[model samples]
Target: MAVQSPSLDDPRVLVDTPAAIVDAIPPYAPRSEREAEFYALGDGQMLLNIGPHHPATHGVLRIVLKIEGERIVDLDPVLGYLHRGVEKLAENADYHHSIAYTDPLEYVSSLFNELAPVMAFERLLDLRVPRRAEYLRVLSCELLRVSSHILFMGFMALDMGGLTPILYSFIERDEMVDMLAALTGQRMLFNYMRIGGVNGDLNHEFLSRLGDWMSRAGRQAEAISTLLNENEIFVKRTRGLGAISRGQALNLGLTGPNLRACGVPFDVRRAHPYSVYPELDFDVVTADEGDTYARYLVRVEEIKQSIRIIDQVLHEMPDGPVMARIPRRITPPPGRAWAAIESPRGQYGCYAMSDGTDQPYRFRIHDPSFVNLQALVPILPGCLIADTMAVNASLDPIMGGVDK
Candidate 1:
């Protein structure tokens, strides 16, 4: 038996297909300099500006990518769009006045931002934070960590085109924020942590609400896991993508879950033991595979650990003054001190130098998002152009922190 093929000369098929029209068209000279420049791209690679506005960027993050077709040749992450000159602003303000300015650094996990400066100021002035205050600090910090990671996981999934996870994650996040608001006045940027301790003690309503949220946390966590963790599309998109070795992660100054994802057991709370972290018993979560999926898993595991820490803090909470006894005006002698905390993003630290006056001589912050963001420079090369968003999401550099 023989099979007859359709002929290219068939007018009906030719008109229906693109080939006949393309062949019929005649080539013309470049009409202007713009047309000539556009045609010149045929012989060379192209540079694309993804955004200072695209949705996947998380903030006002612009990534300039040089590519050869679908393969990325180079990527440059542009920052400073959200910069408020926080360090400079803090230097001009009084030691106590500067605490509020730190809130926007990592806006999602604002408690950690507040914690760094408060700890630094406490160390600089040799102020003693009460045991009850320390427990409150740990509880607030851990709750913020859990809340930040939940949003991070949701955004990571959202970048990969999953919407349900963000919706479900927000449900949990609002509950946590609501409880935090009952303690402090604000929900997101709760400038809760003060120099000696927290602004106020956790109220009964906040405690009762926290207990309710903790009880059902596992179910909500499982909902997100079911949506993404083992899904074929999520796995295929992330499993082996943007892998970094342990040494490279260390060399790049990666920290938090991004660093832990590379199998490094370095956590500021565990290693340096700040506040009540030394008293708390919780395992530092790490993943051997340093890929996007591994980063996701590390955050999820850390959320569980944070919940465990919160439970312990609640159970063993001591009764004492939430705020330490201190002078009305804080005028520390000339001294410099640095303090760090394990934020959801990484090692968030603040350095303060007192000049014998009320204001700090110099105030600086070490934002983990800024350090973790550099990981993308090494990880992005050779990845497909589409994978750029996935890699950025895994790095999770909040521009508020990065550009502060």
Candidate 2:
């Protein structure tokens, strides 16, 4: 009689066979001090895996949760599920073409991705962008900011079991995307900004579309806000749910809206003064609560501020060439340059190193999501398993940027 194999559920039954290889028991062992400390569970405590694939964790992030009863004891976020070696690819490409590689880093706000590298390369080459070009950059970035914030509102609600807000978001978001497509040919990964300027100038079609959008964008946003902001369930679910204190936010290196929500008011635009932001008139939006609800409110208020910026750009946009006089092959001097911009999520920065070559010796990106995701490690503890997604969605990190 042939011996029977162990049950598939029995992970301890290791076998040196092809069938077992397909469905084998993978043994667990601690690889580092952090892992050893986190996995050290006591009686009645268990480890619950959230996702490299769950919707709540968002965009291929694996979070191992240590829970005792209904309360969360600790969590370890396992990253790199979406890493594509973006920096290595940029280092290999020439400076003229290198801007394209950063587009997918924060795919939702590709214009800002292009802006950082373009600004950094301009520094190395010692080039001044045309006045019109600077204004155009601000206009495009502010528009992208509003679009990203609108998407954030939808996702946060959907994560909390509200489906209608996402539908409204898609409706409003598609209109804004179409306006961008009028300016740049691509809808998603737009490699529009070049070394010293944008790929194309604003045309009549783009202007017409933008005008139509401006007329209705604010009204549309308010309509969706009513569905969420006043709802008793939404208010109760999010308010004070994940209160990230100012001290905690600063310690974890949180930036963008997450930082501003905690009453920090540290925007790259206002503090560092990049591009044409100094010329524009707008206030940095902030909230004092430092919780999930406040994060949502901060983004909502920012939408209005971005619209105000766009109005100023349209009125003050000067006449000149959008692109500066630059060579076909850009070769910067032997030095390093850094550029940072206020993106939809936060401060998107790029560091370019040159050794007298058309290609950068080293290209480093400082993505906001990578630093902001740390907020969860400190904020998630002591919250219930049910409140996980509500808190995560409020942070609004793009996994593409985080993994890159």
Candidate 3:
């Protein structure tokens, strides 16, 4: 019997070949460049461009992958497609005016982005926010975190093949957004925090309503947890998927729930203690599995913890001015400083370089989504393609945050 070898020119072979095989073919390129530079050194392997729009790419992300069978040999993540030149725009805007731009940078968690820039500006000007203002900021930030996490939980469940939970999650989120909208006048992109304090005080009626909403939200969260937590399908889909160990997560700069899922008790609220966090009592949630399930569990527990923090801030909130006594045209001395807050996703920081002007000389944002995306390369190789969406959703990255 004669064995037929596969021929590259055979149309049948090309047509019948699997996508993995088709992806192995190298694209034609210029030969003027160094071979070692143009092509990876050593044995030739087919390179495939996964996407700038692939659902699993997270958002507007392009990944160059060298794969052999189901195993990813090498991976390169390409970003910047969503970049809107926010940092550059901030340089041109005056100190107070820049808050508008930061609000859109992390669209999902705009409140935190606003907080980062305004808080940095406040620090630069040595502005003192009133105790009431501090508590308000804490309350709102925690609420924003809870709102963001609820969205994540819903979307993640959707990616995991459960759709009902997302609707339930969004029902809770809509209520929270309505509550925030009542206070800030904007649902998602709220430029509510100013250099010295919040935009306005929470009226007594608003507080009374918020307290009632909080009670209802707490009960809703508990109900949702009971429905999803014990569901066999959810457990099977999430459990033991996309595992990341503590040391690896630390090296990759993973923060927030992604870091906490690895059993590392390093929350900015607890570790650094900013805002009114020092006075508020709340537990830092952690999980040992460092897997998708662990990440989900960490966030679920975090929502509960945020409730505890908000309750304390509301109960003990003091009465005073919300803004500082800084001059109308504020300017700080030439200096640089870093300020980080416990955003819904993780540690969101702003590194501001001022040149003794109202406008910042240079502003750099250390967004957690961008940092957390790094962990994908190490973890993607061993998992199946279906699990790609699972892992990406587990990371819960917002492209605006990553690109900005």
Q: In terms of TM-score, which candidate is strongest?
A: 2
- The global Cα lDDT (0 to 1) of model 3 is 0.82
Ranked by lDDT from best down, the candidates are 2, 1, 3
lDDT of 3 by residue, 1-404 (tens): 88989888888876797775555334466354443342462365556666787654557887766666665665666689999988999999898888898988878788899888887887787767888888889988888888888878787878777778778888888888788888888888889998888898887656766878876766666766786788898888779988999999999999999999998999998899878888878899999999998898888898889888888887898888887777778788888878999898899999898999889999888899999988888887766656767888889988888998
Off by over 4 Å in 2: 1-29
lDDT of 2 by residue, 270-379 (tens): 99998888988999999989999999999999999999999999999999998998989878889999999888788889998999988899999999988888888888
TM-score of each: 0.89, 0.94, 0.87
Query: TM-score order of candidates, best first?
Result: 2, 1, 3
List the candidate 3 regions with Cα displacement exceeding 4 Å. Answer: 1-51, 54-58
Better of 2 and 3 by lDDT: 2
Residue-pair clashes per prediction, in order, are: 0, 1, 0
Better of 1 and 2 by lDDT: 2
Error of 3 at 183 (Å): 0.3
Model with the higher TM-score, candidate 1 or 3? 1
Q: Each model's C-alpha lDDT?
A: 0.87, 0.87, 0.82
